[model samples]
Target: MICIDSISFSFECSHTVLEQISCQIEPGHCLAILGNNGVGKSTLLKCIARIYRPQQGRITINGAELNSLSNRQLAQLLAYVPQHSNAPHMMVFDAVLLGRRPYIQWDSTSRDRQIVSALLEQFQLTSYSARYLNALSGGERQKVFLARAMAQQPQFLLLDEPTNNLDPRNQHEILRYLQELARQQQIGIAVVLHDLNLAIRYCDRFVLMKDAAIYRQGGPEIITPQTIKDVYGISAEIIEHQGARLIVPQMDHITKAADDAKTTANHH
Candidate 1:
């Protein structure tokens, strides 16, 4: 299990983004971090991945403090895919191959190439293996970045708004893939997401961050109607059917109905 104990973070000139936030990410589970904008969802992921240092508290992986591990050692244990991809002017195959750098020594090995090839195929990017990343669409580039993260073969994967560039079809496809990946590989996966329906459908764990702290954290029950109103400032209904929970956002007032009522009152 990965434990984040009372971690807080801030910038020198900005306000504190995270305040004593703590959570556990266990292997063989996928968690979705939910929050409105500027609530520090992305910053929390950065702190876990060691991209930004927290001012207070500690982060540990299986009881080993992250501070004790070197950069290479940390990379060996976790892989992070940011919200954006800044792939260099290189072929897709080569870009994905870079994830194996921590394991590669002296020169590229056949095993390295084999792993890269297998990922490309799994993502349906085999046809674009020779194409440059710059030539692909935004969604394609995002998928390539995800493939690279998988190539790392780490114990955990951290993703920030991974579905941003994907279409609706692709969004579900990618999330389903990650769901299976976590179940099959026993890897802990944390994704920062705003899509409540998708989160309920795909993830086994939920952590709802609010005002720089965790407002709620648990399973599907945490995403109740009142919880939605409290966290998102909106009314929503949760319905279960066919072995899945769906969040149906409630319409506050229907303008057409209001207008009809007004017309009826005027006639009366």
Candidate 2:
């Protein structure tokens, strides 16, 4: 289990990004971090990944203090897939194989090659394994980066908008794979998501952040229509279909606001 206890972070400009945020994530469960833009979702993810340090808090991994762990030890326990990815002029296969660096002992091994190959095939990137990452599309490159993270075989996976560049089908496919990885391998996955319905469908746990703090955290039931209004400042209708919770934003409400603005403009 990873326990975040009263963590707070601020930039050098004195703008606080995270404020006393606390949450717990365990193996075999996928936690979705949901919030509006600039609500410290990415910052919190970076904090958990140790890329950003908090001023006042302690993070524990499996009952041990995170700060006590060395760099290599931390890498073995945690892997991060960023929202935007940049790759060098190298083959995709070789790029993914880099994830195995934590386990490699100064030389590449057959197991590393096998793991990279399997991930490429799993993500349907086998044909592009020999292609340079710069030559691939944004979505394709995102898939390769995810493949690399999985290749790391870490205990915890931290993703920032993992579905950013994926098509609808691929989004579902990747989420399903991530859930499977959590259950089958007992890996802890914490992902930042913008789509409420996708979080409902795939995530078993939820953390709603607002104003740099955790506003709510629980199962899907915590995601109420009012919650949407509070978090997104938009009216949404959550309906049920075939035993699934679906969130549908009330576009008419937005349109009404727009019409009101237009009326005020005409009057002026």
Candidate 3:
């Protein structure tokens, strides 16, 4: 389990990015964080991943403070996949095997090789294992990065925009794979995503953020038209398709009229 309590962070002489944010993510669940650009979605994930320290809050993993864990110990518990991954012109298998660095002292062990090979096969990268990272396509590289994260065998996984550059098919494939991991391995996954429809389809729960603070959180049932208009400043229509909720943006005319009325009232 991961617990975030009143976490806040700010850059030097800059405005606060996160403000008193708190959330608990249980094991075997997938939580999706949704927000507009520059709303600190990535920052919150970084804090949980321990890349950035919170200025005024506590982050605990399984009742232990995050700061108390050593680097290898922390790596054993959590694996993080950032938004952008640039490989060092190395073989795909080599890059994925690096996830086992915490376990290997100096060189790759037999167990490490077994895990990496299994992950490569699982992600359909075994054929490309010998290929360099720079040679693969964008979607292929994304899969390699995800494979690296999975090779860590961490209980908790944090991903930042896992499907940022993929087409619809690859995006669905990647997210479906993640869902399977959470359900089968009982791994806790916290992902930052921009597509509300995708979040509604794949995520077990949703965390909505606005202006650097949590606006609301719940399942798809709680993500209504009012919530979208309030949190995203846009109107939308929600529909159910085969048990999954789909959010469709309403035409801008209605929203524009509402904004115009408000503007006229303010001038008056």
Best by lDDT: 2
Give the higher-lDDT candidate: 1 or 3: 1
Error of 3 at 110 (Å): 1.8
Q: Pick the candidate with the highest TM-score.
A: 2
Q: RMSD of each candidate? A: 4.6, 1.5, 3.3
Q: Local error of candidate 2 at 197, Å?
A: 0.7
List the pairs of residues colliding in candidate 1. none
Q: Write the per-residue lDDT of candidate 1 for residues 32-145, one digit (tens) a residue.
A: 999999899999999999989999999999789998988788888999998776779999999999999889888889999999999999999999999999999999999999
Measured with C-alpha atoms, the lDDT of residue 267 in candidate 1 is 100
RMSD of 2: 1.5
In terms of lDDT, model 1 sits at 0.91
lDDT of 2 by residue, 1-268 (tens): 9999999999988888999999998899999999999999999988888889999998999998989999888889999998766678888999999999988999989989999999999999999988999999988999999999888889999999999989999999999999999999999999999989899999999999999999999998899999899988889999889999899999999899889999999999
**TM-score: model 1 vs. ground truth:** 0.93
Report the C-alpha displacement of residue 242, candidate 1, in angstroms: 2.7
lDDT of 1 at 166: 92
